[model samples]
Target chain A: MSALLDVQSLRVRFRSLGMLRALVTRTPDPFIDAVCDVSFHMRRGETLGLVGESGSGKSTIARTVMGLTPAHAGSVRFAGDELIGLSSRDYKAYRRDMTMMFQDPVGSLSPRLTVRSLITEPLRIHGIKDRNRRAEAKRLLEMVGLGEDFAQRFPHQLSGGQARRVGVARALALGPKVIIADEPTAGLDVSVQGEVLNLLARLQEELGIAMLVITHNLNVVRHITDRMAIMYLGRFVEQGPTEEIFHRPRHPYTEALLSANPQPDPDAQLARIEIKGEVPSLMNRPQGCEFHTRCPYAREHCRQVAPGVSHAGEGHVYTCHYPLNT
Target chain B: MTQASATQPIEAPAGAVLLEVRGLSLDFGSSRGRVRALRDVSVSVPRGRIVGVVGESGCGKSTLAFAIIRLLAENAMITAGEVRLEGRDLLTLTPRQMRDIRGRRVSMIFQDPMTSLNRVLSVGQHMIDIQYRDKISQADKRRRAAEALTRVGIADAESRLRDFPHQFSGGMRQRICIAMALLVEPALLLADEPTTALDATMEVQIVGLLKALQGELGCSILFVSHHLGTVAELCDDVVVMYAGEVVERGSVRDIFKRPGHPYTQALLECDPGRIHEKTRHLPTIPGSLPDLVEVPQGCIFKDRCPHAFERCQRERPPHYPVAEGHTASCHLLDETRGNHS
Candidate 1:
């Protein structure tokens, strides 16, 4: 069977403001590669995590997959149906099977809609019956661990974790085959974060849905994701099993990301693999390897030539001149 | 209460007490009723040490930070308690006394550095404005500003000072705010989620910078954050707040190794990095934070605590000793020991 969601060579770029200014001055077009030649696929009932720092083009990939943002190039096939450049009318089928959850629950939800109406709004759009929709909304709320009494509560009335649950319920309203949750547990208390994460995991199991969880949090990724992809400068630097990647990350960028997570143990050492500088501006991405600028193992070859993707092991792919934990 | 054992790795900073808070209670006046933000909360920061106030949002961690500096909202009432800085009570201080003590003595660093630092002002002017009332000449002020910026690891500080706040990155802007807070050598720094807005890598850098600066400047820090890992790495002491009250307080080593309070225990378990291997479901505290406007008198965390019993519902348990210098205000602890005294 075809993978639940197959994305091949997703290349998304936005014309930099410099490009616009260049038009006025008649200079070369300056394009920022928000997502460049990234390819990954996920099967039904599996989760693929997209992990990156801010400006790493992780969010852009999520938005593009949701069809909220137009992709400049590449194919996004959901269950063998092309999602890229589909007509508005044609997108309806794609839309119903795919829904997104945002980082900020309050911002994602409308102030005007009560919990019941907000959750049922997706069903209403898809033309589900009013009575059945209300019943489904209540079920959705219960599924996310909220009581039916919460149906009357407005977005403002809900706590951060509660609001996030409401967001989850709304995402589930349409029975989407694929759910894209961006920083699903961000800004919640660590305890509350566990609640949301558990809810998502439980839902994923019960519904047997494909999910793409985009987050900067490695902990979030390690807990729920089956397969994971690490993004740097709008490209997938590594893709592998969640356990394999966490235990033995082959890329230097992944090493930095893993080390950045402060261990709660007082005795844990925090050497912090010194990645030299910030994620560079998209306006002028470094030539050759995007990570070469901050990579600790960089040599003469790295600065001049980018390395091809190297298959490290079973279901593991990494692009590094000198891979670690061989 | 007994002190944490010497075997514990992270020792408590030995600096003299810089700020002491006792029974601090605050309520926000509203049409419905007073929203109790803080309730009988107390915390103390020793000189050149970091005391982390950690909790869920609306758990009164930030309110406690604001209360420490006596800079709560206009509608916020200091209903009870004393906030003493260097042996002087700030709660009873007149507006004039507070004005002199605020930036020069006990300054605060908020979550968003851009909001706290003026957008219009150049990085240099941000520091210069902190010393606006000083009798020092312009040259001295400029020199001090340059030195402060340099101390914060801002390279080529003198030249970079001319750049506006927008010119600096999020991490650098926060560093500038830290520099501004340190301009007058404040005794206590109230840093509330200072690195929350920055990326993970940037947070590591900022925390490292703060640790180094705290060492050099000998300033006490009431470092507030929701991230337990950050607290564990940077703080000497950690105070876990639930609802509006201080649920647990102890040295980092004591709290992390032996969390007396259920809330503390839950927080530790909830922390992602603590688990080395993959687990199916995370242990979550069942219920949500209680409504502050109508707080129940018993235990605030009673609804969520796994070990909560009938006594938790009926009576408000006072802070019980768990270990030397470690305490938890939980009925479970009170019952487990069989010694309320």
Candidate 2:
């Protein structure tokens, strides 16, 4: 089947504010390449995981696809229609088919709105009204594992888990085919995280919606996604089947990332394959390969020249000079 | 996290007991009401070992840590308990005395380094504050400050010392905090969710640095965090707290392998990292943490526990011994007690 959403060479850059800032500053224009030439696609009813650190631009990619963040270059084709430069009038219609679940549940939700109104807000925007919207709200609440009793409660009245449930319900209000869950389980209690993840997984299966799960959590991606992409320094370093890439990562960065994730089992012996130092700021990113500074196997060529994409067996492909052993 | 093993006799598990908290109970008297944050919470941090305190938010994990250093909010008061550091009760210490012990003996690294470290102050000034009690020369303070920064792996320590807190990245700022905390070489360090704000990659780096530094420095760390994976990785001993109570306490291996308490078991299962066999529904505790303001009379975890019975709702369950030095608070263990009290 044809791809549901196709993103090609998507580049999102944020300049150091505009207008008033430009008038105040004399230094050369500073910009961070939030998403640098990232490309991927998702089939109908498929789940793709985007794994990266805070400044790795996974969030930028999500926002770019949603047309919320204007792109510097490239195309976001949703069902063969270009999302870039879509007029404000057309963007509203485009939004009906795709929705994003934000990271902060407490901040993302309106304090004044009850669960019913929060869920129904999307429907109301699209002109659906009255009793049907209320019925749909109750259905959405139940869909996310909340009972009808939750519909009347305000955001403050609900717990963190309940607020997240309402967030998911609101995202599904428009019956979107594509769901972008941006760190959906972040800031949640471990037990509550499991519940929300389980609910999202269950709903994805039942509704058959294509989802782009963006998170720093490797475990979440491992459990939920069909395919995965590992982003580093705003670039997609690796992309393949979740199992293949995880079991035998072809990229040096991916290997380090996988090993870096602390396993819950106390008996598990950890290998010291961690990358040293924090993620580099986008402003002062490495010259050639973004990961060369941290990559254990980096050579002289790796620092001066960016590695090209090397295809492995099956759908596995990674941009690494010396790939990890299978 | 910072507690003495109050009711239990000090088995003294091969390491010198650095900090011992006994019968620690804390209450926050708000306009809403008095909320009992900690209930007879006891923990012992052995010398040179990292003890992990794992629990959900508002589970009194931070409250217990802050209370040990006597840095709780104005509304909060330590109603009962004693925190003994080196056999001396800290609860009885005055504010001035407590301030002296706070940085010199027991230093705390909060979750956010940005807020904890003064925004306007240079990284070097923070070190001088800690060394204020000592009549060290300005040069010595600067030299020692740079030395501490270098120890934590910050590049160009001399130049970085001039940089403000904002100039440093999240990971770098955290390193500065750790450096400043360990500047005077405190006997014990109380880290309250130090890496929660950091990214995963950054977290591992910080954890590694902490482990390496702890090994070299030979100082005990009372690391409190909600991330079970991180806790398991860094800690030798694990204390699982729920609703202001120590539901389970044991060696990391014992807790992971044979979690006796239903809450601990549920928590272990709930971690996404614990997924061995792929399944649609991840096992959850099924309920939120019980309200702290008005704690129930019986077991605090009874409402969410699958194994809880009528007896669990009626009477509070005391900690029952399991393996050597391992104990779990549960009514189910009462059967193993052979009907004894």
Candidate 3:
């Protein structure tokens, strides 16, 4: 299988001024690594769920893939083509093959524009100048389970679910091969979240598009994802098949995440693994493993040396010194 | 189901039924017309018991909280209801009487701590202001503020109290809000989605803190949230609301095990974990919430219910007893023809 999207050793850093006369002197700019040495691959028709807490640099990786933010070091390849070094003209053309869906649907969709104009704006921007643009927009809306009448209504007129459908329609306007959705159903109700996930699943099956779903909800990954990756502080702690990772989780962080999630069952009787303390700031990340600070099974070596990725099984890799159950 | 010894009431020392809401209904009146926000909603929070009001957005959970505090906006009116706290009907209280009761007897912690806490004032000032109104000495108020902050697990409570709200993180700001709500030691604490903005680990920590506080203070809590799983873990009783009406009311165990209402079942099935073991795709309750202005004459969930019958569309279903204390308002429960009344 050919990789549709590939990122290697991606790094993003932002510079901040130091305290005391640095603002006046304009010197000693401190750099914070938002994304550090992150790598992943997406194959066609595959869904890769990126699970992480806040400040985990998941959104940074998404933005870097979309070319909204430049990587400090590493390569981004799409279909064997290097997208990192693409010129502005070529990047614009490359962007037509990829799109992103934001977390907040209402914020992403312009309140002033009707559903038709919002969906068709991408087509118009890509120079698809034709009278059939409106008809194509209506079709896109219908495909997303909205009626043609919604095309004439503004964003404020639509509900949260309807707004998300519109966002999906806009992302599919150019028929991109890879779609990156960031927290697609975070604030939605449980029933609506299921609907959105089902919609994404059906769309992926029908369109044969690769998807990168970034979310904090572990249940979502277990339901819709083919493969999953656990991220903490701009690093992939574990990545593997969804079933294997859920059933036989190797990393302690992964185990804690699963345990922290409240299952619907009343009699499950699962051990509650409570993670103590707050997530360290990216500016001052801990030495060795980023998760060593919170791992319940951390040893002396776990805090002194960063663990490298080791293969646990077929297509399963985890970065932990002492994997659970040996 | 293993029932707790009914004879030996699970009681909190110094505990009593703090708040009892009966037939509460609220309406938002605009220049054009009136919109019914709540319809015949009733709930009770016993002292020291954590009663979780679970529902999705626009289910009138927050409105119920605001109405209890008499904090509803001018455009909104309590059409019909009685809000009683400790044998006193809050609905009959004037603004001045409500002011005396607001912090001393009943206090609310809103969802967004960042917005709820005054940004311009320091955390200590906010606590001091809340305490000073109760006629406590300034030194005693400061001591109580520090103690309250320490109770919520805020380290360096004395020094941190001098900092402004912006200086605290999201979770820390919430802790400060919790401290403010606890400073008065109110009989009933209304927490409106207190953990929604927090991370999973922080949420657990805050909920644990709340549980500890409930154990020590013996204050009843009306916890409003959209997550049923959280309610299952933390609450003693659960009220499932849909479109501003109570669809199901029962103990957490009974509700999770055998949900009678179709909406309750659909809500349970909508969760991925419940359906994870099955081979079928996840089931969704189809359609959105009904428009409040034009509420359906029958069941509000009939539009999305899979088991909707002719009667469900023509008449509202009355509450049917399912268990010792479990009740559901659904026509499916009526099929047995056994009425608890």
> Which candidate has the highest DockQ of all?
1
A1-326 per-residue lDDT for model 1 (tens digits): 67989999999988766755888877676677799999999899999999988878888998898887889999999888889998767787677899999879899999998999999888788776645766787788888889999999999998888999999989998889999999998788787888788888899999998999998888889988999999888899999999999899999999888898888878785467967656677777787887888898888888888889999888899999889999
* Colliding pairs, model 1: B2-B324, B2-B325, B3-B324
Per-candidate DockQ values are 0.76, 0.74, 0.58
Q: Write the per-residue lDDT of candidate 3 for residues B137-202, one digit (tens) a residue.
A: 888888889999988888888998799999887888888898899888899999999999887777
Model 1 chain A: ten consecutive residues of lowest lDDT: A269-278
| Best first by DockQ, ranked | 1, 2, 3
Looking at model 1, give its docking quality level: medium
Tens-place lDDT digits, model 3, residues A1-326: 87889988889887655565566775655678888888889999999999988878899999889888878899999998998867667888877888999999899998899889999999888898864977898889877999889989999998788889899999999999999999998888888888788888899999999999999988888888889998888888889998889999999988888888876766664698877777888768898887888888788898889999899888789998889955
Judge candidate 2 at residue A45 and give its lDDT.
Answer: 87
Q: Report the lDDT of model 2 for residue B311.
A: 82
Superposed model 1: Cα runs more than 4 Å off:
A18-20, A128-131, B1-14, B332-341
Quote the true-contact fraction of every model: 0.82, 0.77, 0.53
What is the C-alpha local distance difference test score of each model?
0.85, 0.87, 0.84
Residue A284, candidate 1: Cα error in Å is 1.7
| Models sorted by lDDT, best on top | 2, 1, 3
User: Best candidate per TM-score, number?
Assistant: 2
